[model samples]
Target chain A: MTTGVRRRMGVEERRQQLIGVALELFSRRSPDEVSIDEIASAAGISRPLVYHYFPGKLSLYEAALQRASDDLAARFVEPKEGPLGARLLRVMGRYFDFVDEHGPGFSALMRGGPAVGSSTTNALVDSVRQAAYVQILAHLDVTDPPARLDLVVRSWISLAESTALIWLDGRRIPREELQAQLVHDFAALAAVSAAYDEEMSALLRRILADEPADGPFADLVGQLIELAS
Target chain B: MTTGVRRRMGVEERRQQLIGVALELFSRRSPDEVSIDEIASAAGISRPLVYHYFPGKLSLYEAALQRASDDLAARFVEPKEGPLGARLLRVMGRYFDFVDEHGPGFSALMRGGPAVGSSTTNALVDSVRQAAYVQILAHLDVTDPPARLDLVVRSWISLAESTALIWLDGRRIPREELQAQLVHDFAALAAVSAAYDEEMSALLRRILADEPADGPFADLVGQLIELAS
Candidate 1:
């Protein structure tokens, strides 16, 4: 890529380019801290030209958030062919990857704070959660989950999210281990819920049946057996 | 209380009164939607006087958030005298009480969004989670917890927060059930962690020893046993 080439970009292309630039900048620092001047300079364009695509900071911030929301939601999309444990582990991998690159922006959006947290932004963030829920449901092949099942999945989603957010603060825990532990956490949640409801009990059995002995779910079982012994 | 009695209040007293007024208003609606003018009116004071007491909306919102932060953290402080399940249930009752009244503001704060989510406000909110961690540690009576224990507690805190936040959206679940489920979740999380670590196993045993048959934690054990048999 030539640095000095002043190639003309189409309107939509320029908008996409600006959103990408703003996302990169916002990802590095909190949205409140990143200014328009930085965004323009990073894009190698004039500030007013950037505003021509976006009317103001709020608009650009929303645009970036929308982009990030789509990207983050896509992380939860997994092929359902593999064991549930493996599928979930891959999902966690992508999630942490997104968190690794977009910590500040994702954290602020998730926490519902910092600059540009309008209703639209809030909805965008929520859509990500909603999307994750749907994807998890699809993986389970269940259209209507039981109440305990609902609680376990939603709680695990929250756990994964909060785990990633806190992990970003200092990353004290090893990433790979946290990822595995999160999968175990999900299995544990479902297993505990299994004891509460018949539907949940059946669902938990069905899930554990397909998992390999070496999978994260089996690791959880092995750990539990250690306690029993 | 007499009707329309305008009593002259002292400086600190007046500030506290204003904070209380702002808290009620913020509790009912998102802080961004609740204007300073509304707060002033709610306090039965002139807008100028309100501004005189607190320079601006952000300052006033911070004051309200600070007060809320203290209230929230206090809810986590159990007597450490009962079965862990009963103690946690009581704490959840108070927590849900806060959520019932302060859903909008608390949700907005916990999610990290909307107006007045400055670094200071974020810190204040974080302090509440930190305090809850300390209080739970005191309940468990552990000076230094294992790494897995740390993960479980912090993850549970995040779980409770997200659970309450999501429940507030439409409250589809019965409040009493959700509250009880939350205590079960804590036990589930700890029980899972116990299988992973010896320290956690011993701790789980100790926590379960004092709990009654009908307690939430025992109910979880009973449910799980039903799955086994």
Candidate 2:
């Protein structure tokens, strides 16, 4: 059988091409299912060339994971326009988009298996989470959040990630509903945190002030009061 | 050194004993680090005896995971006490206790590694989640819930499990605080669902009636309204 014509690309270009191919395969299947030979063949290169870029399958998998991490982190970057609630909704929309676009890779990246559950992969995942935390704080306009606010934000992030994972896995809920539920959960968590922390409480009041009176935010508040009374 | 005296227990007893020993080991270390030799040694039995009960390490790991699942499911059972919120808190306390006691085994069972990520283990985990869902519905006194209520309850269960896993991994927040946070998230998710579904809205009203005027539930409702207005 004749092999496909290979392009003479520069080192960085060739490396990126190999990683891009690997990412697609890894997204579809676990790391163990994807072989160096398949990746090399997919790139129309020799196995030695693949090895030259990544010493082994695990290394190649990590590189792909890193690329995915970068892509996901970039997706969290929304314009700091409008109210915090509106900005969060936009950010969550992009997050949902990323999860939709990179379904398998997002699962593999967020929910690591034995093949990719090493400390290296854990660090990569943590970096993505940290990036998310930084972006959320930036949206909150908090450069140095207190410990309670920090914990609440981190916990909400975990909740969001888990919610997204289940939503993707189940395929039952609509993406918009899930996104709205998440944004509501974020506000609820922030309000809950505010009950105990002055800083979060103050920040929440400010955000709520920016929310429209008849929007979902106002509806959430109305429901809360209805339940209380 | 002389081998210690080994008790010749019945087959089922021996199998249970081996699983108990394996559970202890897996609770302390990952499955890869625990070997048949270590399990046999821990049980003061021969490697062949360990294999006799479990065909291999994977089977043994599955058994340990099953045991963990059983224990976790059992922990979700709370008495039909005064109020749904209080019953949930009691159930959550027991759940947190189980997680705290199981530690690494809890992590392994909840976050399945490739070693134990088989369909068998997945079924076992699903059973535990289903149990939690049933218990929650029972607490709500819902004989037949709508799809939206089912989805919300199931999602909250996932959120609770994910929150527990993160709390265990991070070890930043106190167990009580995390447990309270999860219970709060459960209520918030329910309330958010209520905003869309009439059945859930009615159920939320019933749960709110049981909550004390000056309790955390009331405080949560108060804070939410305060932030909104």
Candidate 3:
């Protein structure tokens, strides 16, 4: 009789089980295509039980997306011990591995929905990613203020995401080759972007100290510094 | 009247008119919301005549997208003009101008499909963009092999598209501020990306010459080089 009744599971275990089932379903189909009934049937539970876990389809989808994101972040953001380049390569290796393993899930999360629809999830992902970038920035000795950090972080992530997506869309590239290219591509771009900032920041700081009045190039430099920050 | 009918309205002029009308409609409504009839009506033309000019809605959208792309490319890729840094700045400014002036259309294209059900349009935009990137690489004096050239072009385009979208989101800061950040950000990243390519390509060329059994990295790099071409 006890066995026939629902098995009592801790909240974390229950949530994990649901996420596992949800990930399997989402991988097989798109977020919009998979219904609550399918998730319940697959999970060996009643439909209402699935709803008890997640209130609606969007909620379920977001959970599944978060699971995938968490999985990737876990692999990608390890505090590996090495030189900056090697450490970055390690992080990127995990990143490439996750994408290679879960292409569809990654696409759905990164490319799906308007930004406003799931701002929370987006923020969560962005924060995890900012930590990863900061790790690399630390290696590079980039101690820019918060605003500058924001600019560089956002810029690099944008570069990395788009480059990865294009390669994923049957660009017919093998995983190892793509990963290598990504490493080189990202590392090289980071150097250039940092150099540009350093040059502009120096010029702008000089102008700000000496000239309060807006000269011809002062406004331009100020604007450029604003951007770098 | 007979002479006017026979005379060729410059292909460029006709193309401009079609793009202008399509951009107007796409700006106010989501791409799915706008239809051929509306575009024709807005342009003061018969529906059939619009069809004759554009073939279909996708073609019209592609034309509008292309026009925007051309405007942007013209602004950025000024060959025989200036250093890579200056050229890149001009290009970034043009992108900011584009978003400021045609916010919705730029948003739709950058946001990707469901705003416009036209992969063809996306591809057309990509091709024009790839060409522009190639021009920029040339201005930077990159003398890499064709395969390497492809990689440089692709990675650069990725940087531009990603930066533009991030700015358009209008979340982090004002548009004006974001635009300046973009210029500084890419200038740094692009220099790094280009520099890294030099190292990777040299490594790849040597490996290919050795013709040793390909490892995972070799295979992936080979596939990426192939795809880029």
Candidate 4:
């Protein structure tokens, strides 16, 4: 590692580097358990320099959290023209892969849920979740009141958060087995949120446009309303 | 408040008093934050007397936790015999009432989930959670394989735990409002658990026998499945 290369980095790069290092440490231990002094030492900068970017430890912690959320959001919000279902599956796949590689970071987030208010964390999680819902809503050609859309989106957020926690816990299920279940679950959840047969059928067309027409998930969600009825 | 009255108490009564006092403290603060001396002092007894029934602070914490779980399980397994829908609704009503009274204890249980795997707390939480599941299963007519039954029960547990946290965190959705939404969600989840319509219908029949027939949640499970399909 060259000092010249580190010195020449822009402010944005420095911020990202701090978050990256903080996430590494936070994954291994609670944020409180780690000190700003330690984070600064690990980042190879003076403690005051760390404070220059972040006002304090709490600010830094929230910033690192925001960085993680932004990283996740980038994967979820694709260009508006793709097949919704396939894009959704890709987002979920990316989610699982991210958690798989950052097991500690995932655990830290789950553990942080109660320490922070849902409103605090939801700002990050809700944005990524709503972006996915937008694709479905757009493809379904539906127009609804914003409040109702928000409720539906929050419900989907709850399901995805629950599913994410289950996967992150790394219990008995393998990643493949878990991802397969999520694909089915997310599709069913999406269909329910749309709440229009014509809309669903169109959404299904969009979903199947980019993938094989008859996965188990397609069959399962294909008859979701029937099973629900 | 007479000294004579206090001295006349039996060993069982004294132990119960100690537990009651310990629970009051434990509910307000984490286990580590409270101590044997404080508990004994709060109960108006000597420290050694507190240890006579519970060998140590951990045992006392476990005992208090077990009592809370037992109380919750008892409410869930009410003996009322009627339509499945009515019974289910009654149980849910009781469950929500329990939350209103004991939300802190329930929140503590959830926040303690990650701690269960730690050496200091695992056995108590695992056993109590298992006992709670047994109570839930006894109320259901599950014919799924044991593994599936375990997953179904865990799914319900997850829902209940998450719902309790949402409520405890002061979302303050009216009891009926929350229960109605839950009934819908659980019904859809129940339908998806089993394969055949007959089996699903039968399960719903048994469940509906425990709920009211004409309310918003009465046929919500079937309706949600239909909407999904």
Query: What is the i-RMS of every prediction?
Result: 2.8, 3.2, 13.0, 7.1
Give the 10-residue window scoring lowest on summed lDDT in candidate 4 chain A: A145-154
TM-score for all predictions? 0.85, 0.81, 0.55, 0.58
Residue A120 displacement (Å), model 1:
3.6
For A1-229, candidate 4 gives per-residue lDDT tens digits of 5564635568888888898898778666656577999999999998999998888776677777777777776666555654444555666788777666556656655544333433445365546656666655655455662432334344554555555565555454455544555555555444443433354445544554554446545555545444434
Candidate 2 TM-score versus the reference: 0.81
The lowest-lDDT stretch of 10 consecutive residues in candidate 3 chain A is A220-229
What tens-digit string does per-residue lDDT give for candidate 4 at B106-223? 5665554332334334455455556656655666755342443454455555565556566667554456755655555555555444433355446655565556556544555444
**Residue A139 accuracy (lDDT) in model 2:** 80
DockQ versus reference, model 4: 0.10
Expressed as tens digits, the lDDT of each residue in B31-149 for candidate 1 is 77888889989898899999889999888889988998898888788786878889989999999998998988887776655553577887887799899899889999898987778
- Predicted model with the maximum DockQ: 1
Candidate 2 lDDT over A100-173, as tens digits, reads: 87677667566545454466777787799899999998887889877667776777787788777777776777
Error of 3 at A181 (Å): 3.4
Candidate 1's C-alpha runs over 4 A off are A1-6, A32-37, A46-48, A56-58, A111-113, A145-148, A209-214, B1-6, B32-49, B111-113, B144-146, B194-215
lDDT per residue, candidate 1, A3-23, as tens digits? 887889999999999999999
- Give the Å error, residue B203, model 1: 4.8
TM-score of 3: 0.55
Instruction: Give the higher-DockQ candidate: 2 or 3.
Output: 2
**Per-residue C-alpha lDDT of model 2 across residues B53-155, encoded as one tens digit per residue:** 8899988888888888888888888878776666777888998888777778778655545564466776787789889888888888898987667767876
Can you rank all candidates by TM-score, best first?
1, 2, 4, 3
> What is the alpha-carbon lDDT for the whole of candidate 3?
0.57
